[model samples]
Target: MKALSSYLTPVRACGAWLLMTLTGGGAACAQAPQEATQDRMVAKVNGAPILVSDLKQVTDAQTQGIRYQFADDPTKLANEMAAVKLNALDTLIDCQLLADEFYKIGGVMKPEFLEQDLTQIIQMGFRGDREAFMADLAQNGLALEKFRELRERILIMNVMRARIAGTVEVTEESLQEHYEKNLRRWSGPGKVKLHTVTISKKTADARSVADSLHTKLADGGDFEEIARKSSADSHATRGGEWNWLDPTDLTGTVSEVVLATKQGEISEVIEQLDAFIIVRVDDRQEGDPKPFESVKNEVTKSLMDEVSKGRIAERMIHLRAAADIQRMGAD
Candidate 1:
């Protein structure tokens, strides 16, 4: 989103100008300062200085994850980190441009809300002490008025985003198109519903008990009733009802037994280390491709959000074109 390229200014000059413009002039900035680190002016958006420290705050967080990913390749890691820094600075510039645009349009927030937020912060963070708040601001090298101005910038940017999003419109045709485009996502996964009866190995004559139950179930016995009365599994209280689940997640022989069993039919006695079990294949739920009508509201909302995001990006492009953005030492 860089509106224009910029040259690197001497650290002393940059620092001095910042002080002069921002703080109403200070001591002499006649001499070159020490080798600038994070205090270096990395970019400027409409004359607003973007320090390396601001860019670092964003890139450092991203590099933590990226570093681990390219741990063995230092060159790759460095390249990725550099890209992250550049992108972070670009995003910061975008934010500045948006905030400037908001202000240029004479956007104003209610004074009461800003004061209420400041009051809440004071009460909760500083125990309602005005002196403590002032002292904390001073410690951070900030004045009360400057801090309020920064906070208002954040508030204004948020309102600007909301206003841009409000301009987006959604139609039923768009909803249907989006739903069809992502048909696979809207479709349900294949699953099964099951019932079980378990006979614990610790029970005397466990094999006999399992055989009897299996036979009863095969002969049109009430599976729920049999499971409730005989099952030793945790789900025995629920008549051995298992939730609709993907059979692939079931381990070892249980998966085989369930997959082999026909729908609405009972499984044979399955022997396990801890127990003998039988199951009923209550239902096989194959992936059901959803109709557009069934998920119309969800699709509509998703399409609206996507379109709104595109609109915002377009807005940023316009803002950038009208903006004065400069990045130092970037070809």
Candidate 2:
């Protein structure tokens, strides 16, 4: 029996089987006579039957996270499960409608391509062991031929999406508009690369030392060299240089002096709580708004996503309206 490869990528194939493995498919594989009679329809699209088992498969995959989240609350779990099942059923109905439309609208995909993709998926999912792959199918109660039909239908839906939603392109205007609308996201805070010279209050002439250092800076002394020789701060070993400091990270006289001082210039002696110090802005960068060229590709992709979402919703509505769709039972 041929496996349906078109609907599943190598990654998605593993994901499907992983979910099946976690949920355990023994019940589906061992249906009793009474269980077979109990099987019921959940939905129909253009007379194509969607069974409860179909809804169960989709909802089972979706509810894994929810189950983990509400494991302790049976009431919440039941409510959430009902919502998940309803949403999954609606999705399956739309998928069927789109698939039917895809064939009607002349979509075509070669079987050879699907077969090749399927081999890759199987190799990835079961380490290229055909027996393991088949065993998994048996455990999941999925016949090879039935799985192929399901995959073909899913592939048709994908083709419909490519024609409708995937064709959308983001315009330059839209990209620019998105960039402008979200300026803060692209802008960074102002930062300063500062170097300092300090004199400890414990030093008998701390004020005199600070004053002399300020004068040396004014007289074209090398700030780093002078700081290394005389500064008494934590950063003295690194020529009293402080890495880029954000505005909010500084306070008191240091903040006032640093903000007021021009880049590449030194401040006059300023008294701190227990020391006299001087600061110099080694390098400062004003937070400039990100240029259009820098974020154009990202903005374009974001705009395209918005357009694609709208396109899919619009196409689904059009397809559902044009097709004969009926929902039976709980959703």
For residues 1-331, write the lDDT of model 1, one tens digit per residue.
Answer: 1100011100111111111011322222111123323377878888877766545534544566576666654434666778876677676676677667665565444457667657765776677887887776664444555455444444455556666767657677777779989886687647999999999989999999999989988999988899889999988999999999998687556776787788998887877767888989999877777888888888887787787777778898898898788889433
- Candidate 2, residues 48-162, lDDT tens digits: the string is 7777766665455456656666665443566677887657777777667765665554444456645754576578756788787777667556566555555554555555665
Those runs of model 2 whose alpha carbons end farther than 4 Å from true positions after fitting are 1-38, 61-84, 182-292
The superposed Cα distance between candidate 2 and the true structure at residue 316, in angstroms, equals 1.2
N/CA/C clash count, model 1: 0
Distance from true position, residue 72, model 2, in Å? 14
- Quote the positional error of residue 38 for candidate 1 in Å: 9.5
In model 2, how large is the Cα lDDT of residue 224?
Answer: 85
Give the alpha-carbon lDDT of every model.
0.66, 0.66
CA lDDT of 190 in candidate 1?
A: 72
Least lDDT summed over 10 consecutive residues: which range in candidate 1? 1-10
Q: Each candidate's TM vs. the true structure?
A: 0.45, 0.50
